[model samples]
Target chain A: MRTTPAKCSKPNFKIHHRPIISAAIAKEQQIVGENEIQKSGFNFKKYMTEKANSVNKALDEAISIRDPPTIHEAMRYSLLAGGKRVRPILCIAACELVGGNESIAMPAACAVEMIHTMSLIHDDLPCMDNDDFRRGKPTNHKVYGEDVAVLAGDSLLAFAFEYISGFTVGTSPARVLAAIGELAKSIGTEGLVAGQVVDMVSTGVKDIGLDRLEFIHIHKTAALLEASVVLGAILGGGNETQVEKLRKFARCIGLLFQVVDDILDVTKSSEELGKTAGKDLAVDKMTYPKLLGLEKSRQFAEELLAEAKQQLEEFQSLMAVAPLVALAEYIAHRQN
Target chain B: MRTTPAKCSKPNFKIHHRPIISAAIAKEQQIVGENEIQKSGFNFKKYMTEKANSVNKALDEAISIRDPPTIHEAMRYSLLAGGKRVRPILCIAACELVGGNESIAMPAACAVEMIHTMSLIHDDLPCMDNDDFRRGKPTNHKVYGEDVAVLAGDSLLAFAFEYISGFTVGTSPARVLAAIGELAKSIGTEGLVAGQVVDMVSTGVKDIGLDRLEFIHIHKTAALLEASVVLGAILGGGNETQVEKLRKFARCIGLLFQVVDDILDVTKSSEELGKTAGKDLAVDKMTYPKLLGLEKSRQFAEELLAEAKQQLEEFQSLMAVAPLVALAEYIAHRQN
Candidate 1:
């Protein structure tokens, strides 16, 4: 069996709560498929490091410092700053799982990273989240000034499409167009932007329940993550069934990532995390930990992870699915 | 002979003004080539109205209000707001000149307009130009708060590529890919974004010369216009020679648009012009009228128009090229 709930759950847990993805958890976790896969000895840390390094190299080559240095500097600053490279890695791994190699996925991998970086930069603006730091450095607006930050964000967004459309080699134009459509849908009003506006609107309003919270997280965080995986699969020539399965897998892990983030907010100190901790509690924002008790939240995370892993079991080659299984576990277990 | 040095040329009109496109202008203005073409009597005003109406209809159908209300509302507000529809018209006209129809160019036409609208929204932001009104009403940020306005602009930008890549039908994938590349390049650091940064940087600097002014205009204004025309040519199956000639023609007219804009700055009042007139001079910003002086700027405008029309002389079908010639004259003559 898994570890006892007592040892895993936070001591400060409160029981008065709403059901957070409990239905999804019940539906998705019937089979503990990934437990066996995990025991088969996959070194997730090693896989992540190797993939992250390659993605970094590709991203560096994708964008170089050019004329009008400030915007480029701002772009490179946020882009190169250390993140886990999770989305690009997910993209690459998904591509590989569908019988494509790393080279076929690199342009799209870099493009997703660029889109994520620009979103972060824009989200941190003074008029937006007003955050002064991101990824352990001053935010784009802080370092480059708001004007350049805005332009840099806009430039990065535009260039992501340009890079994907112009730079992708060894792929059919049909697949490329499909990938572009997916990327565009992820960021538009019905996707990332839609989530952002509602999240902003939800602030300071009473009765922001678990459903509302999930809507925001799914749109703001999960949408792009879904796009990342789905685009990779498409670029790799995954068939309809394969693409749909991976999309479901991506959505679960995407939500799992946010639930874990909310849990960490209450459990980790700012010094340990490197960014402001307990920001959710301070703002009284709606988070999983706020809606459900910390214990239930952790349990919810596990259920989602299990569900995510179950989707991967459909792929016949267990070894090919190892990296993705490892990724879900990483999201479930990361400290910051 | 053209107007003499006294009545038209600004006293400050440096006779040695780099002979800007004089050879091309001389070659192009040969009446021996198209003087009879001028007598062919194309009705530009009627052509513009009909084409603009169709393009506006396509653009309307291109984006619609959906799920989350506010962001969609903001997007629709700016996109559907009536402008001159110049870029879309240019795209369609270029396609027609190269022997293609409106249907083949509509997606790209709408895409270019989307890009232009997004740029205008961002440029009007408090962080950017801080303008309070645009397209005859309160700007986007004024209508839907700044946060939503920024997102709206971003959504529009992303959706432009999506609309082109996804909705475009009856076009070859190679042409689609080429169009995407050209559109992306027109908006990135080397294109529209570059122009914006330089224009921002040049605000208060001393001795802003004509070269710097041209650099700003070429990137800011001309790049997208060139993209608009060239993408149309590519989509219409224009040969390399046709594409390159149209590109040059577009570049001339694009600069002509800005030159006329600067002249209007000095000549029109804020009431007469929808936007703030004389704002450029008020800011002590660099402008064509300021450097070339009003009379000489007009002469430059005329030369550029001649140079643009000359490029179309190679088309060999005068009636087919009439709309473009009429567009050049329109840019030179538009009041607002």
Candidate 2:
């Protein structure tokens, strides 16, 4: 789930009167460890660490300080500042699940991470969300002036397409073009930008309902996540049916990721979250918790998780889908 | 030549003590209609009008007002706002010159224009050049607000890649990928972004030299021009030698475009240019005319025009090369 910092300050708006679930109670309801991971005996924790480390190394190598040091420095700073590597991990997992090796997917995995980082940088700009802190460090605009921050984002966005088109190896150019198309759609008007524009307009709008909220999250958050998995499946040689199934699975989790993010915002503190927490409340922004009540939001999250896992069941190999199952759980249970 | 509006006001810096050429004298030196166009009898004005009309129509069809109307509106507002359509025209002419039809290169032509429009939107942001007007109209930020303006630019950038990858037909996938790579490299840190970053940093510094000024324009201006022509050549099935030659030809004209821009800044009025005139001097920014003096700048432009046309001589068909020869002259003599 992506975290966009609050645009304005203080909580003057009233909260919903629905029964609220405390943070402790939400944490106690663990959602994973069902028939999926146990049957496959997948060590998800170890797998995530190995994949993240590999992704980190690949990302580090993808960009280098060149001609003008400042822009490259700013790009590397935010990109390497570190997140959960959720998108890249998902990309690699999707590729491997469809019979492609890690090496074949590495370029694409790094490309998604780059796109995600670019989104974060742009969202944190003062004109957008006015974020001061992200991932426990100052936001890109705060460290680098707004001008450089903007350019840094632009540079990363351009480089994401370039890297995918120029560096992906062992894949047919047709598949690579298809992957590029998928990735581009995920970020353009129909994807991340759509979500961001809606979110920007809906800020402090008290009457916003579940449909609009879902629209924002689905476009802003779910679109890129869908692309990450879809790119992997396409480049990994997944057939049409397999790619479509995985896309649906990704869409469900993408929404689940945002719903959990809304839940955590109200539950955690800034220090624990590594970003400003309760930002939605402070800004009076509509969130899953605000509309559904904390308890109902938690239930909604669980339903989404179950729905996401159900899409993977038809694959007929519990072992192949184990990582994705654990990933949904990880996103749900993550503290920061 | 692209126009970047001035960031600040008042020209307090001292002008270089060098001989200057009057605008009338510069205009008197007609640089074309010599051996190239005169011999081939290509109607340059009619060709440009037809090509521009085709490109504008394609651009209109490329983007539609979709789900979130504001962002798409802003994109269409600037993208469809009238300009010379130089990049797209160059793209089509180069493709045709390389023995390919216009339909085969239309997607790429529109893609370059989209990228160009995106750059202008970002560069006009409050934090960047802070221009209040562009293309003789209120800037995008003034019309749509900064947040939407930024998103609009982002959408266009992402869509450029999507359109090229998704819409280009009759071209091999490998060729499509290569074209995407060329376009991406023109906009990233090593391309347009690189030039903007340096230009931002050098905004007020007075000791800027010829080398640094060239660096800024080459990356900022020439890189995209080079990409436009190179993409056309590559997509037109040009051999490696032909592509490399066209690349060098583009580089010459790219620098020539900027040099002419600097000269016109000192020589034209805002009303004549349709955008802010003398912005370089107003901001005390380094420019070709500032460093080389107007006379030397004019002389230098002549050298570049000659060199740019010289690279086309090896094509062995004067009929095929006339458009490029006339284009180099058009870029040199355009008032705005």
Candidate 3:
């Protein structure tokens, strides 16, 4: 309710918070603009700060005391070692936009972070990416060794569910279960594993097509992102219809974000990226930059961003969705 | 109902069902005892056989896809490659005994199998137990190679939740969520990882003490077994009181099972174990039989079995629980 309404139709404003009558939804044709409220994206920096602190607390509480402190320590070290809290912030922002309280989606936010952290841990393992640096520090397996890293990732992944379903909470059990289900699918074989397999197999192959590229991003990066936003909506009290629209919006953004990331890999520097740069090419891995070419990739991202913004036209205001739109834009241009 | 009046009171027969339990739990428990009135042990073999097929079916259905067949194949191979199916069978049987449908508990059953498979797969990795055989077949890493084996374990772990939350209908979402919570804790740093860590570090440390010995098995073996029975009660309509009692029962059985298993490992040949025997000795790992010596380990298992059976006194009928009671006896005596 504290959100601004100045952007209702301002020329300078790229987004508005009110629902648009100009839409492609077949189901919403009749009642398109009636009783529709606009939603703007929330503050990325502020949202990240608040949610990061909360998620850090939950993660800390979740990882403390594993008898032998090695895995717990490694997990905490990787988790707390700072990176932009983009995924959790998106979850919280999406939750807030739909009129639901942030508390309902907090577990989900923490869970997503845990998933991300776990993936990072495994990616850094010697047998995998073998990266020595993460978040500008030595990677988990680099510091803790392969066994500890594997266990750390395993612990984090499991604890993600614990943080949601096991935590004493305000959310309905059904919602929690649904969130868990969505997360499991997204992070599991059909999503993350399939994507990883494709990525792994793509190495040493000369020509990677758009289909395989889409498959990789959809599973590897976008699936969890889509889950985060949709979960936010579910926790935020959105009906099924609203949730579906937001899911589409998030899907576009997630893909766009990754495409931008891939593009940045070709264009950015390690100092600007905060992590190693151009590793994709180093490993001969296929990326959006490789598949679409830089200019075409940028165009593709813009199209996705436009589609994402259009999806938000269903809402009444730009306040709840502005950050998301901005985030997509930022992603499109991010050096990292 | 087919179970008749027993000749006398069998202490373990308190939960006994006539040829299994009353009307309600049969569909859920899957395997029924010979008769309701009979007084006897809670044997798990029948329960294991009955539920194993269905669980494998559910697992197969859960992994459907055009791509990622390699991951699925490895996961399925490890999942169905035999083993007693003890933990999953316990989950289903517990659910049935509580008067819940097996279909409702099927997800939990499959989840346990997934967790168990993950443990086996990881344990078989070169850095871990390094075995080429599990339950009489080539271990996952042996057949699939270490990289696929690792991903396959991860895939199975993720798919467990997907299979459950995606497939089962009519069950309370809260229960499914709660089951996930239980599993995460048991499998995370607090239970399985913690146990494995201690197990890993304790290797070649021949000067291990009793307290350390308890710690290892408590986590490695008991945590999952405790999770198994607890999940059963959750899905089977068990009240908190019943769940708590069953957890205690499971804890005891878990330790006892390990003791017996360690004993059998020393006693049985490679042909009997379907893997190399004397593995603990070979790896110089700490085990119950290693620390306590054979006779003491046997005595300990028997004591634990008796204690486990004693915890079942509260169940309404002995016949319904015969399979479980018999399982306690069999745990101590089984050769493989």
Candidate 4:
């Protein structure tokens, strides 16, 4: 089997191409070494590029301009707007990790991204965050009138579920239903909406603490991320245990992604990311950097990365988890 | 069985309690003439009250205030705000017409109502129609602020599919998935969103003819009502042909409901319906009364009612269709 020892911090650690141990054996071993077999050969940049391309193509084809050219145009404009497609890629990777193929998970991958895009569009509305720009361009409401933008957001969201349930093929009905349920729960009041509401109400409140901040992030960011991963695994025909493991791993990565984002906001200038830097601080929005100092926030990100990586330990093959591991590292180290 | 021949316009029409013909024979006969035996024993008022009460109970239990109580409170407040519960009743009635009990269709019934309520909440936003009141109470955005109102609408829409897929019992997975797809499609861009966008863009524009007006109403109102009835029939195990026929019936009734609503807007005083009367005329919004004369609008409603009733002629038992027939008449004759 091909092995890449150089990817690991310790010379003794090896990246094995073949299954190293059964999950039960791995549990017994309690695989504890941080320097063990990191499998950096996953080539995350290439994987993400490929996955993003597929998701983008699928999303582009998903919506068409029907009647009332205005709303459809608005929906496609925001939905097809460029973003990293992180949630979808994570979903596809999770599905593959659980012995499922991309065809079975692609519809759901598109769904998560659609939901994410709609949330961003609505969040940037004048009555909401009131941000004029998103992804270095004018927000949806800025391009379309507020009325059309609102309807566009609603349309995208409704289409997400429709595409998933109606367009998915070669999958068991049970799995598809399960995935739909998971996707819905992630966005409703107890999840993304809850986080958004709390964030909106907590703005400029001095008494906000670590717990409240965590609550916001878990709902706003992690809930959807976890749903994406869990849905991929479920639709991929993963057993309950496998789905749960991926959920935990995704939760860690979700929180890690946000922490690193907060860190980057303080560390990078506005020109670097094409977005306003230190805006959270300017608005007195409760963030990891605000609740914990920058140093502690960085430490928290590292801890989350470690926890995310640890969840992958039970996988039969490092190769199977290579993409997920690389994704965690990418979140930890992304420059933008 | 109790029969009320007096309700029929023709004395020759008789209300039959038993199945008079086999489905095959009924299809072959292509029964015509309005003076045929019609089931007049159905008490629409009592049936609607019972179904509405049950649906209200189900919807009340469907959503709960969890964390971030503000959004949940807003969602429930708007959702539980009393309307006639038309969508849910249609769903239940269609299911019964297909020989399925209310238990088989209640989840989908609740889901359609949730979707309807969400649409109303979003439509009343300051950016949309900007209506201050709905169902005789302050609008969601008016009470909760626009930010929370948007989130509340989103939460309800998402929770709708989640509740149907997760909480549904004693139904096949295929039917449940199919119903979810139908519900999503009805509310998406080609459906409710399409209607809303057209209405918003065409506002204050003169020369909107009957075709354009029908286009708006077909999408804005008929789509959800059609979905409600079709989904209920599907969940109740209606064959494809049966479901399709019911879909046609629903389409007619849906259009009829709108035309009557337009007629009432012109004829009723504001005090009668507790809503603004002649508001459509005030805004120059195209309506049945505006395009066609009021007399023609009333005649159009009657034609639609006849078409809707004609679709039910193939049913083996008049008892199965009595409520639906009554609903059509109610739509045609309702003062408000």
Q: Tens-digit lDDT track for model 2 on A168-219?
A: 9988999999999999999988899999999988998887876678779878
Angstrom error at residue A154, model 1: 0.2
Error of 2 at A25 (Å): 23
Candidate 2, chain B, TM-score (2 decimals): 0.90
- Expressed as tens digits, the lDDT of each residue in B230-280 for candidate 1 is 999999889998998898888888888999999998998888788888888
lDDT (Cα, tens digit) per residue for candidate 1, span A1-336? 111121111122111232333546545554534466678777778889999999999989888998878889888999999899999999999999999878889899999999999899888888777887776688988888888888999999999989998888777988988998899888877578877888888877766876567778877888899899998899988999899889888888888888899999999998777777887777667777777789888888887786677777678887788888888888999998
Clash number for each model: 0, 0, 60, 0
- lDDT of residue A45 for candidate 3: 59
Q: Is candidate 2 or candidate 4 better by lDDT?
A: 2
Deviation in Å, model 2, residue B145 alpha carbon: 0.9
- Residue B18, candidate 1: Cα error in Å is 6.1
Q: What RMSD does each model have against the real structure?
A: 6.1, 7.7, 9.4, 9.1
Candidate 2, after superposition: displacement of residue B112 in Å? 0.7
Question: What ranges in model 1 sit over 4 Å off?
Answer: A1-35, A38-41, B1-18, B23-38
Q: What share of the true interface contacts does each candidate keep?
A: 0.77, 0.88, 0.73, 0.90
Off by over 4 Å in 3: A1-44, B1-47
Please tell me which predicted candidate would have the highest TM-score against the true structure.
1
Residues B1-336 of candidate 4 have per-residue lDDT tens digits of 121101111222122332223334423443432233343456668899999999999999998776778888899999898888989999999999998989888989999999999999999998988888886788999899999999999988999999999987777899999999999999987689888888887889887765566667878988899999999899888999899888888887787778888899999987787677888899889877777788767766766666677788777776677777777777778888
lDDT of each: 0.83, 0.84, 0.73, 0.81
Descending-lDDT candidate ranking: 2, 1, 4, 3
Against the true structure, candidate 2 reaches a TM-score of 0.91
